[model samples]
Target chain A: MTRVGDVLARCRAEGRAALIGYLPVGYPDVPGSIEAMTAMVEAGVDIVEVGVPYSDPLMDGPVIQYAVETALAGGTRVDDVFTATAAVRDAGAPALVMTYWNLVMRRGVETFASDLAAGGGSGLITPDLIPDEAGDWIASSESHGLDRVFLVAPSSTSERLTRATSACRGFVYAASTMGVTGTRTSVGSAAEGLVARTRAVTDVPVCVGLGVSNGEQAADVARFADGVIVGSALVRCLTEAPTRADGIRALTDLTRELAEGVRARRSTPGGAPGGASGMVASA
Target chain B: MTTPGRFGDFGGRYVPEALIPALEQLDEVRRKAMIDPEFVGELERLHRTYTGRPSILTEVPRFAEHAGGARVILKREDLNHTGSHKINNVLGQALLTKRMGKKRIIAETGAGQHGVAAATAAALLGLDCVVYMGKVDTERQALNVARMRLLGAEVVAVENGSQTLKDAVNEALRDWVANVDDTHYVLGTVTGPHPFPEMVRDFHRVIGIEARAQVLDLVGRLPDVVLACVGGGSNAMGIFHRFLDDTGVRLVGLEAGGAGVTTGRHAARFSAGERGVLHGAFTYVMQDVDGQTVESHSVSAGLDYPSVGPEHSYLLDIGRAEYRPITDVDAMEAFRLLCRTEGIIPAIESAHALAGAIDVGRELGPEAVLLVNLSGRGDKDVHTAAQWFGLLDDAALQSAGAIASADATGVSSLTDGVQV
Candidate 1:
């Protein structure tokens, strides 16, 4: 099994934060998407989370909602998402998927998990599917050799902490705020608290998403968690640049910027020495 | 009795921590502004001049003649601007949004009429509008898309699960969560957490308030029955409000039976849905026993939701009004019958009430005066109706749409007033 500690060690040794970018399943056209993913890999991407658009994306803001609509209108299906990931796999990049439980539930978790595993997907991140209500999914996904990435918010209870750790395989996603996914100018103090609380529950790696915007925010967040997941900022990357190449270039540039920021702090002698950088240096 | 504004044990504000301060702020300012002389005056002026309120009290005698000779009167909201009672609520909510000094409006729409109305109001007030609709509904109601864009609104099609009204409500709730500080969420129907149903009903109450007086003036008596369609129940609630306390006015609420309520194919929440909290408060919800919401359907896209407002639930429980269902076939039949009899095309959603009135009239017989609310005109249903009845090829439906107008006798006919 690919353990959380190992992924964390490898990420630290590389001196890079995991760059997770989400693209709508059939957005900018599906075949065009394969080319884009390959481009993103060549541009130095770490991980990718493909969003399967649903008709009721209860958590998305307008920007992502528009993107999902555009993609679904193009007839993006779960199979299409799997097919779309072929480019990521052929390009040899690890990929995760972010979608609502309803889609997976409707498709039957066992079938979806197997299909996703067969399609070369790595992990799953569902913000609303609670660990308590997700037993069937956890068993099915784990049975199919998939990582069930559970989310823990700042408002999560101790019971939630226990449930989240036991149900998850990959790093537990720690939401930094009380609300839905959105942008904020700075990292909250509660971010550190949530990490500390989750650290007490189990030995699994913890990652934060939903508020980090730039290299500085990622750099700030990298100080505490295993890795940082950036979405809206990356989606913004797609809209900012005129072409897919420019979009890939933007993500690659930010990935490198954040990687360097994490590396500097990791390499400093005895400054904070628990990560892979210290192990490599000591060896 | 029962504090006037409540709906069953389920209609109070059960909001999150973040929404409290803003809601309380709205409460303090809303009551004062709604009751102010200037505000009321402007609202009335717009209601009269722009919307053509004091909307007509119509009599359907041929239909009435069939109904054991009962006198059937219609409250003609279908003649209002934009062709539905949705205009009545949107205008009021829009004015309140403006007075709050907000610059942007966000709403969730299903069939797109409410989105059109909200967009129209935002355009009139020069406010930026963002209407989130389920992607499926967007495809289904494309003409409404053109209408909204012409009004200068941004239409964000949501591709969430089921791609229906409930999902649109969820997306709109998510938007309100992120932008509660600077934006106003103009909820179309009256089913969200709190104050939405109450606030929307207050705006629509003008319909019932006006009709009560008009019916008395015209007929010299109160109606034996007052009826309207119930989707989110805003129109029904609005039309039912003044009659809530009237002992003699028998208010009836009609819900869409879709294929049939028993077959689980309808959007008649009050008939099949149970009491549960959805959106923000407890109300009649189309949820499974496990509590997840189920998808609802109706021939009328506007009424196609799995839940209804809390206040309507309260009304049903307290027996203040009666809730019944009208199937798609029934509503369509009423749609064709009304057009041939009265020269008016009603919205499919509103046609549900027209269906109820037809039944109620037959049962009541001669000497019974019933008021059926024509909640909206039916231009949108022309395409759907044409397809259903083979009018697409029959060449009978698309005849310049010039049906014989029912004269002052409350009945007109091309074929001796015998539709059957």
Candidate 2:
């Protein structure tokens, strides 16, 4: 499996932000979700974050929550996440598990990390777990050689950004907005400043997530970000599709557009390929 | 401050990163307010004047007969303004909102007690208030919706997830995250992130303190057992905190057992829950083997949550408190008994505790002294009770069905001639 850091570095080398697409494992159904995510990769998603659906997705907005609820109702299990991850990776994108912390803690951090690694996962995107409280996870990720990606939000202070990026191994997930994940008309105005603040503190790539739906928004974020993450929009594509084939088609089409969007700003004079500057700032 | 976000293996800030600074800020302010005499003084004065604090402990000989002849003492939190123990937590948090210089408060409620309390606090403090109530809860507790509007709170009926307290909390949290700059999420339970469980419990600690002294003063000794219904466990923690050191006072929490634990439809978390996280804390959550939270059922909307408070989980793990499940049938019977014997229309949530007290009294016989936290009045639940007991007249039944239909269609109208 491609390491998350390698994926980000490759994106930087190519002078384009990585297109990160999210879909919950077992959404619609286990096999179908895997197929859809694999299609996303085939269409140009650089990294795929397979959400392991939880009962209560507190941080999720209506779109992701609906997908997760459907996935949970369809009996999505922890093992299915690994299967989806491996499939997405096999389809050529590094797969990361984006899940609430409870699932990892319940499965035991070390065991979860090892299982994820075995399943071809390159990293984890923990939306809720902060670095200050991630001692065990940091240890587990290091031992398993899996990237530990933590979230930094618009509400984060510079001190918090420093703390978060310090523990990050792959890239820092920058939540563009303060609310739960959803597609909004306008990306939060605070996103650019937050990315700059986070970039000033670490060499880890900074990826902005939350509210980047269409290709245009993806391109807009890609100009300032090392990666642009799209979750609710992709999930919405699957949810709104009339059938499995249609869902996969819609997902791939959107992924292709987002790919173009990311690549569109690559040669722009101000759009630099530099990731976060200091490699060992947190250490 | 020692362990800001933990109760043993449970309780931590398991929220998205966006809320971390807010939680930290809230926690810091809470720490300061905890020691600041002025904050304490304001809270105390409000409790005395507005909330009718020092709620008396009334010994019920008549109700004791139903409790197998044990001396049953009641902590009258029902007499508090807004008619429940929820006022205790809301008033305290409202004060905190002021100290934080916030001008608005947002809260979520199930049966609407907390929403009403929050609305009351907001009204008194001249702050804007918004309450998120599940569509189902707003229908069932329509009076509370009206009451909140009267108190100048915008009651937004949430139509997500299970359409209950859990969903309301989700919406409220979303709102808080989006509006964190000037708004305080007046979380209505002893759950959520770091300071919430600790802070809400502290606000309610007055219950146990007052009841302990009042019980001792009236009965000449501490009760053998303290009983309180555990929904999110604020009241149980409120009454249980002061008696934790008593050693002899067996703290018992009664959970809503809708049908029964065996039927897989109850809210008895400790009985049938697995260790999982929900609503930001690692506690005993009623979840499936795959870790998806299962919807819990209860006759009482307040107790229909799938997870317990983190502190309750810790206490249960350490064997400091015993949790028991009481079925709807038993609880309703207790509810009627409280009304018939003691002239008290107790909330069904509180009746669950009365049911437990009955069992405890039976086990220990007449010598056992029990103090039950009467958490709230049954005013909000009267419509539910009327339907449950088949007490609704023909016109009332039709309107009740209409209300149910309205709730299903996302349209609620309390002024449609359906009298309580």
Q: What is the C-alpha RMSD of each candidate to the true structure, in Å?
A: 10.8, 2.4
- Tens-digit lDDT string for candidate 1 (B256-300): 899998999998888888776566556787765434467888888
The complex in candidate 2 yields a DockQ of 0.56
Query: Where is model 2 more than 4 Å wrong at Cα?
Result: A266-271, A274-283, B1-3, B400-420
Model 2 TM-score, all chains together: 0.96
Candidate 1: residue A124 lDDT (0-100)? 79
Best by DockQ: 2
**For model 2, how does the per-residue alpha-carbon lDDT over B85-196 read when each residue is reduced to its tens digit?**
9999998999999999999999999988999999999999999999999888877877777778767788898887788988888889889888999999999889988888
- Ten-residue region with minimum lDDT total, candidate 2 chain B: B408-417
**Cα misplacement distance, residue B36 of candidate 2 (Å):** 2.2
* Residue-level error in angstroms, candidate 1, position B290: 2.5
